[model samples]
Target chain A: MKNKGDIFVISAPSGTGKTTLVRLLLSRFPTLSFSISYTTRLPRPGEVNGQHYFFVSEKEFKKSIAKGEMLEWAKVYGHYYGTPLTFVQEKIAAGKDIVLDIDIQGAQAVKKKMPEAILIFLIPPSWNELQRRIISRSSDSPEEIKKRLEAAKKEILAAREFDYIVINDVLEDALKELVSIIQATKARANKRWPEIKRLLQA
Target chain B: MKNKGDIFVISAPSGTGKTTLVRLLLSRFPTLSFSISYTTRLPRPGEVNGQHYFFVSEKEFKKSIAKGEMLEWAKVYGHYYGTPLTFVQEKIAAGKDIVLDIDIQGAQAVKKKMPEAILIFLIPPSWNELQRRIISRSSDSPEEIKKRLEAAKKEILAAREFDYIVINDVLEDALKELVSIIQATKARANKRWPEIKRLLQA
Candidate 1:
């Protein structure tokens, strides 16, 4: 059998540049497919329907959830969001590496279901830098920023559970580290055993 | 305290060109220190003492082993060879990465003492290629070549116990994979945790 593609679950606090790092990885590794999450929330400006997320009706999202289509789904701010297992399975069967940008809860859920999934945690260089990044976004009020900083603290503490943690000090360095992790994971003994076996027989 | 250097134990069969790959790696990464083994066997012509091996007397080698200085030692063809643990510890304390070229038995011995050591197995692309390479050496008689091939088979079987198996198909590709593995290993959570902790506090 051909080697199965790896499922990479990346998690980070909101201001840690997780999305940017994943985007850079996708650009560099064309074989990787970015998982499109399903969300019940309204689409924001400049967000494409399928590219950003699969914006679904709350009823439809719940229906799919009830049908057990979602690999992992969670509610946030009174809206539901999830990753579709079927899409991920299909991509993996086609030998495409899948990158999932999710929160810690979602990452844990994915891991529970697929023990082979690689969990990566992205974090800001420092708490001060994280605060600076959150403030620079200018999308949140002072109170909201305070709440996010508190959440970031809890998230950073949870990083010990991750397989790899990429510190986003410099964007270039973080990207390189992320890329290396992905490359090395694919070359792991468990994943490449079939090829090794064939070589032995040859 | 500074980050302790990583001990990388690289093992391969007779014909995989593992030495060439390691030489290329050392040239590329100056931070890595090639571990010089202590050998009781007399040095071959052109082999430098301290550079190639310590070239100690059998009595001195036994004394060191009795004193618990050897990290991993083996007797092959009635000649005793070993790695000096004290020298390795000194270099590690000084934060210099050490690369050990050893056999599976030596690797296992080192791992028993230092569980954190990374073991890498380098393999040929195919058995046919391995046979071809071994034959090309032309130093051994036909019967000797047959015995060497038998040993190679056993060594390849032992690769499953290693942390990583690098397939030496193309020289450049294998080098890149080796580099990526080392880079990713240093970025692993356990090794990078202190820096991450400092970053969080900062």
Candidate 2:
């Protein structure tokens, strides 16, 4: 029998460096897997069927949600996005740590279903820095950038509920802290109990 | 204002190599300090005052306990041993991580008073290994060894309440895990909030 690996539910407002941190972490922890989300939106060019996301019809997504197979789902810009419950459960049961990069609302949903999931909120150094990062990316319009900045303010307030709040001030330091948190979780009492017992009895 | 360092409350049954692990950990982390307990028992020859323990009269120990200066105190074999609250508090406030090598009961007491304290329980590789270690010490009487073995069983039950459990299967692996746990605690959200703010604002 395999011990279930812990889940890391990471959330951050746009420009908190969450994407970069996750990418770096994945590279470092080769055993770690990223949760492949399901989306109703049509796949853009170069997006694989099950790599970037699981592209599904709205009807299929709704059917899975009704069957309680979606861990967390949300609607964005008239498109549906959701995390498949089985994907996370299977990976964890097979002893593979999966990182879920979700929003605050999705994070809350995952926490409610799997209270054992480690909730990490990534925060930028300051509001101004976050705003500057968003603007510098040049991916959003003036109005969209303003809306995201406003949303970041509200999201920062919810960081209090997270198990760990990683400050993305310096990329290296934040990444190190993230690594520490993950390593520590793997050594938690519940996860180590079986090994401890076997060690004590051997 | 100084950010308080994290506290580690470590408990292990006799013969689990807790002492050696703590010693190695201290050497690795220069900022970590071991808590010196105030003992009413007579100091053995070669045991230096204040270095091994603060040899104190029973009356002096009781007085300190009454004044709420003792973080956790207990009587073993008709002698009183207590951890001084001020010593630990001062060290932590000075940004020094403090390790409390106490029994399960004392660990519980410390946890109650300092809710943020991280509790770790160390487990031996095997029952035979634990027995071998205790016997190899050649200090305990036959009856004393038997009594200790019984206590170890009870101590293992309390491992459930601890935050992390390090299994001493291989000395190197256990020591590394211990270090990771301490480093992770220092990087906890509450402890790192200040540094994160400074980094972000820099």
Candidate 3:
């Protein structure tokens, strides 16, 4: 049997402070390893191949799917995106905690496979604030922004299904809370059996 | 609508350092609280009502059951043992996180009622070690110890159903990990919505 690693899936509306919170979490806990998705989409300006995504060709992406290699895959913005199960498993085996910034659908899929993964949904304070944040992203036009806002409402509702709901109200405080949770979950006796045995022997 | 506090059910066979972990967690984090179980057993010397087990009459305990005041209840050694639903609900309402150190059956019952509650199973390093610890407690006879160990094996197997498993290998290290998990779970954007809202407004 494989020892499972805890997966924290942080989901939110595009501009509900998820990226910032993730960045803060990464910097605060260098031990945290972020999961990079594999995408068939072209890289945006200044985006590195592995850092932003594992930019793969359609042929390779298809081959991966044929090999049943991905943990979860979805079509987004006319491109294919997926999480490589092997990459995550390897990082976890190396004793590093990994975070998955994914959509609710992807999160659910991951959990269905690994039920121990923690699903954390980030919500905007309110519909109005979510609306404002979406408009500010500047990656979309007026019509596109409206579509995103509409999608966000459904996504926020999806938050109800998540394991925990944290509002991105404050940056530092939210990040601190996350750090505490990761540490706390590991303290569990079942997860710490080997360590506990070692400690008791010590 | 109630913004419920997270319910953490912590269970372990005797002498796996569960009490030490909980005590350390409570002392270190003021936000953490313990759920005090209520029992219909007569109070021993120096035991106070409500503070220790909420001492009550069998009639009163049965009345509580009729009123649905208990979250989970069991008759043990001619005594009724249970958790007061009202006490735990009140603490949640007041925004205090509560930890329940209960039996496996109680944990399952509570989880069914509050599906959001996180379940953790604590274990000793090994079955041999668990036996040694129980024997060392000086509170049970060899026969009683055998019964407990036998029961523990059943409980440990059932732990596979729990959300997380923590080994009580080293008290301090195990406590630290438990602290970390609780921290991360609470920090989850889903759970921290209120704080996130307040922070953005500030």
Candidate 4:
């Protein structure tokens, strides 16, 4: 019974309700934990240490990057954010399934290091809804939002590389699909064949 | 919103509860349909014409093989058993999820033809339990039991090629896993990406 914590790498374009879905998953699946990212960006209002991010200085962040401690990192909105490999590995060792709330680049980096990780791309049901949501939830200006949407084209293309693509049409349906994927991934032959063989021997 | 029938190819050694699990799946998910296999074998005591198998003459079976109408076919216990391609294709076209109860060889054949099919292999929790179930059921004599056990060895070895290997340790657990697998397979990125992209374009 090898019950190792498996990482779920979630990638989504802006305005796909990725954050809300992540929170919903946290509430729905008790076994899941979030992988807090390390960033050089200053915390926004109401953001707390270790809750939102592990804020670090430019020099410290760069040092971590140089040491290859980051599973995936990128400079966005003139700030750096990345998943720390050490923290994720530690949580997995503690038998907690961790969600990597990352962009495509970060997801790819994690996949390269851990081939067993499940990569899921969250998709907005329609472009009109996506644009509407992005505008409505503007933590960014119109100009900034345009830039993010432009970047999204490139990000959405990466969905083709993911192991699963979840349509964020309805929150409940998407969440149900996500949990089912976790359960089903665990039942994969590569994961369970050994146990079955051992049972035969016993 | 395209609802393509997701396909699950399930294989198991004899007496591993595959039949029971599949029965539960059919009743549990109204959207699913089990592929009816065409066979040349004379029906066993209680088997029906289209339920246990779609009985056909040896000539008809060979003709189907020549016409490439069988998805997969093999000789078993001196008779031919095969899945009819048209039956599976029709159900899928009609948007009914399809489950093919097959051996590993049949699963491999189907997978080669349909690259997207999800393969699930079922196993008993232990050899002792499997043996007990088979012997206690008293379906065969001691000599026949030995042969079936030997065949089980060869069949279980082939489980490695499957996508998921579920242990029927408890029927409830195995059935839950099977249901989860069918749901999750539809979420595979390769299967969903194009549709997601199209929805976004709309």
Model 1 chain B scores worst on lDDT over the 10 consecutive residues at B193-202
Per-residue C-alpha lDDT of model 2 across residues B19-130, encoded as one tens digit per residue: 8888898888887899999999999999888988999999999999999999999999899999999999999989888999998899999999999899999888778888
| lDDT of residue B162 for candidate 3 | 75
lDDT of 4 at A5: 80
Q: If both were scored by TM-score, which would come out higher, candidate 1 or candidate 3?
A: 1
Candidate 1 backbone collisions, by pair? none
Candidate 1 docking quality: incorrect, acceptable, medium or high: medium
Between candidates 3 and 4, the lDDT winner = 4
List the global CA lDDT of all models.
Answer: 0.90, 0.87, 0.79, 0.87
The digit string of per-residue lDDT tens for model 4 on A113-166 reads: 899899999988877787888888888988998987777767888899999999
Looking at every candidate separately, what fraction of the true A–B Cα contacts under 8 Å does it contain? 0.67, 0.50, 0.46, 0.93
Global local distance difference test of model 4 = 0.87
Provide the lowest-lDDT 10-residue window in model 3 chain A: A193-202
Best by lDDT: 1
Model 3 per-residue lDDT tens digits across residues A27-78: 8878789999999999999999999899999889989988989999998878
As for DockQ, the candidate ahead, 3 or 4, is 4
True-contact fraction in model 2 equals 0.50
What does DockQ give for each predicted structure? 0.73, 0.46, 0.28, 0.78
Q: Best DockQ goes to which candidate? A: 4
The CAPRI-style docking tier of model 2 reads acceptable
**Per-residue C-alpha lDDT of model 1 across residues A64-114, encoded as one tens digit per residue:** 999999999999999999999999999888888999999999998999999
